[model samples]
Target: MSKNPLTTILEANIFNGTNYNDWLRNLKIVLDFENQTYVLDMYLPRALPEESTHEERLTFEKWHKDNRKVCSIVLASMTNDIQKQYDRHDDVRPIMPRMSQIYAVPDQHIRYAATKVFFDTKMIERSSVQEHGVKMLYLVEKLGDLKADLAKEMYIDVILQSLHPSFDSFIVNYNMNGFDKDLHELINILVQCKATIEKSAQSVLVREASTSKAKGKGARCWRRNKGKTESTTASAQSAPVAPLGMGKGKRKAVRQSLIPKDVCINCHEKGHWKRECPKLLPNQAVKLISANGLQVVNRSRRLRQTVLKFSNGRVVATLV
Candidate 1:
């Protein structure tokens, strides 16, 4: 293939079909691609071996050794074009050790200006909760006692705006129902503010599941060994662990009474349930009367007697 001097290095096999990041990583080692016309002040300074971890230092050393003939070496410092105020020397010192094990030290901040960003599904699932949680918690902690809904909304918006390209992808295969639509809409609304709804929701459910399982297993095991000699002795020796924060005012949930399947409230029949009742109320006198044959009867006295007997289930004797 016919190629110009500027484009000759682009043909190098290092970039064979790899993604943007992988291609950049491979090409950086195999070829010197920096243009002589570009000024150093325009570009952000690269981290030096002295401040970087062992692996990073090694990588930097290797890159310099390979490209020493073409590119000049410069230390990352306060003089460099800092993308953020927090990107200063002292601020990044605590995070340097993590570079030994990590492949990339990506700045995850949601910057107002254009900057480098990337995303992967694996990272989304793994650190989505922690990263977003930290952001939300930081905001909430900073705001302290201010309205939670407002704080959450603001935080979620920040996170959504800060989303890496990969996380913004939409999968159209799944068919969502009304409930799913509502939850997703809520999550999206929250996501727009900076709060991680999905991760936080998942974490809460997982926590409850684990706690419930543990309690169930403990109760089952305890019951199984209730009469055993070792368990009896252990129980007798150890002091009981009292429940925390439980008080007389705190009420436990009462399970709802089950509806009888074969009973009908409308018909007073024993075939179907109250929920399936289809009868409509008839328009009649509110009070039913046994006025077929009456011999000078007092309505109020009779009504009082009927009410007393119906309420107490007792028939009082009357002198004739």
Candidate 2:
């Protein structure tokens, strides 16, 4: 218990009312790792019945102890607002099933969150550009799954915008040429470009090292050229880096998703999905794309990223 596996997962991802699905899976993983999953599967009676054998009583005692441990872990994992509501008096099922109901937000909120995350996503420093690009693609896919309308150009631009400044030249060239390419092709081009930039940097380093080796004439010549270098450096530093995606006043735009026709399962009427059916039962809850639903969305700060770093030292970041 001293080394809880849930700590790391919880540190990165808290329940926070919005990410229950992820928290639930992570908690389950903790239980499974500790060989305590039976606490959830085997429901025990509050008290032993008369004539119950010693074996039955022993099983009940162990189950009760394990259930309390799991319940404590569950409550500790949740945020204060949520933790205060659940009373730990019985098996874990009673508590979790109700939470599943309470944590679900409206589709309108989900749609808004998804859209915001797509726009605000920025590539992490030292991470793979291809990975960053792929994550952007996944965000677009999530928007699509939510039935949010988006233009192809917006999708492409959003990914391009997420990249770091190392890709400014590439972005400018791409915008100028107006090449029509999908997300996969775009990622490939970025991978190649990153390699090229790194190579150029390596060659610069090699030339500098070789020049330093010639201490006599080379050192004298280098010192003589210092003034010219100083002037060039000052001029280069003074000229600001231009923002990308500018050609004939090219600017970024995000269009609202076009609504598709829907047929309600409950009412058998057009213009609506099951989630918002007008004739549903009082206790029925319709699911969206999957059982987990809309997935927990991150509302990251909106970013105006200008740098596409050429750092590939880290592994590729996957879309979780």
Best by TM-score: 2
Estimate, for each residue in 174-285, the C-alpha lDDT of model 2 and write its tens digit: 9999899987888899999999989999999999887777666777888879978999999878755445755533332111113575778778899867756756644354
The residue ranges of model 2 lying beyond 4 angstroms of the native Cα positions read: 1-18, 21-97, 124-126, 215-217, 220-320
lDDT of 1 by residue, 1-320 (tens): 23224433434422222233333343343333443222211232356745677887775555444333223221121123321322432322222233223433232322211122211112244355345544544444433333223434444444444444434532221122222333235445435433454566779999999999999999989877875867778875773433567553332211112333576777898766554555532222222233422423675556555532436667555433
Q: Give the Cα error of residue 318 in candidate 2, in Å.
A: 99
List the pairs of residues colliding in candidate 2. 149-257, 149-258, 164-307, 164-308, 165-307, 165-308, 166-308
What global local distance difference test value does model 1 have?
0.41
Candidate 2 RMSD computed on C-alpha atoms after optimal superposition onto the true structure? 50.4
Relative to the true structure, how large is the alpha-carbon lDDT of every model?
A: 0.41, 0.76
Per-residue lDDT value at 186 in model 2: 86
Model 2 residue 317 CA deviation in Å:
99
* Cα RMSD (angstroms) for every candidate in the order listed: 31.9, 50.4
